[model samples]
Target: MNQGLIPSRYAKALFEYASEHDCDKLVFERMQALSEAFASEPSLVKAVRNPYVSRRDKIQLLTTASGSTEGDSAMTRFMELLADNNRLDMARDIALAYLKIYRREHNICLVTVTSAAPMAEAEEKRLKQLIQRHLGSATMEYNHLINPDLIGGFQVSIDNEKLDASVANELKQLRLKLLN
Candidate 1:
């Protein structure tokens, strides 16, 4: 299930193209829209993957799905290239890879917090502050996940690092220790 080589290659090419053309932001926006549409509409992906669908039709559908008719030429050409190669299925992964580069270039960090229930507003604010302190000058975006299986407590994830304090995780660790 892991995406390797292809997505990153395409994403790097697209990123370089955008950077060269001074349209990285525009391309990023288009890719964001494309990724969101792929997530929200299952049929869109099917259409892109369907062999019966014409290339022009696929491009048109993808453009429409992006929710913008007047998309940047670079992005439009990128979409065409993906369709021509019959690799439209990799669009989402490419977009995600592009986003990672964009975030790194923009000094933005995505943080995820998972807990048994929704966090209170005060707790959320405090958590943001704490993350901000750790991140220094970089900006932080918080995505909260509610997982009842956590039982209680929360976990915070930043890039490759994760701090797990969830009750379920703790219990599992304790069980392993006792078993040993």
Candidate 2:
């Protein structure tokens, strides 16, 4: 389902709070960790959403996922608030929204490349250079990923714009055309 404005609103509120105390950077780091954890582990979402799990347990899980120290008040308080409101299930979405907000605030573009297999260092360097030529001085954060299901080829995304050249995608399009 579409997240709508709820996650964005939560993210903004958190960002504002962090900003008031010059802790936005810290919060961004925490959110980044949380977002990465959610991406790497699908089951974390389920655990957060599970009604049987106690709020304390969920908070502990979130703290651990953030890789924070013994107790970070901001992170701890935020988790508590989420748990209290039963909004923990939306934590990942909130974290992702916050990331976009942070990147925009910092004038950083997030570039991600996903391929069937890991690209060679030289190939990756050339790809990044190609991207830099197009971006023209925009500060960028690069992320590389492997999705074997792509079958072959690569996909590059600069912020919201995407170039898909995956064999799997081509096959899917061909299948649709043949069926029609």
Candidate 3:
């Protein structure tokens, strides 16, 4: 199995199932939580990836780690399927793929705004509006981050595209020009 293909296929199947059942939002949220957990708890991910772990045990650990067992039938079934298929090791990648599907289906754009200082509410609002105008017809998930090293100004990253207006970047460009 190709490394990326397995998780992508699994994610797409889960997404389609959720969409058909009108539970895509719920599953998407669950996948996001799982992805975050995989990122923060490398040990947990390692345990899941371990070939010796039984399917039942992996399911138990995953459900317990998620802190929810109160009738998310879709998620439960999905996890069981992954365990059966020996695809539990690809949980993180599946979650990532699920998120991409969710965002695409819901017309959402995840954007990060990094600046030297915290942006005021109005500034944030204006920036979001500007982004919406440029991107067109999508809801933005605006993540505001502060980086003192930026010196001043801000940078906006929408998906893979970056708009760099940071002072540090400008200075680097200036330095490069001078060197040239």
Which candidate achieves the best lDDT against the true structure?
Answer: 2
Report the C-alpha lDDT of model 3 over 32-133, residue by residue, as the tens digit. 788878888889987997879888889988766654466888888888898877788888899899999899889989899999999898988999889989
| Clashing residue pairs in candidate 1 (N, C-alpha, C atoms within 3 angstroms) | none
RMSD of 2: 2.9
The predicted structure with the larger TM-score, 1 or 3, is 3
Ranking of models by TM-score: 3, 1, 2
Report the lDDT of model 2 for residue 166.
99
lDDT of each: 0.85, 0.90, 0.88
Could you give candidate 2's per-residue lDDT for residues 43-62 as a string of tens digits? 99999989899999999999
Identify the runs in model 3 with alpha carbons over 4 angstroms from their true place. Answer: 65-67
Q: Which pairs clash in model 3?
A: none
| Residues 48-121 of candidate 1: C-alpha lDDT, one tens digit per residue | 77889888888888776665556467867888899878778787788888988888888889899999999999
Quick one: how many clashes does candidate 1 have? Answer: 0
Error in Å for residue 142 of model 3: 2.0
Q: Is candidate 1 or candidate 2 better by TM-score?
A: 1
Best by TM-score: 3
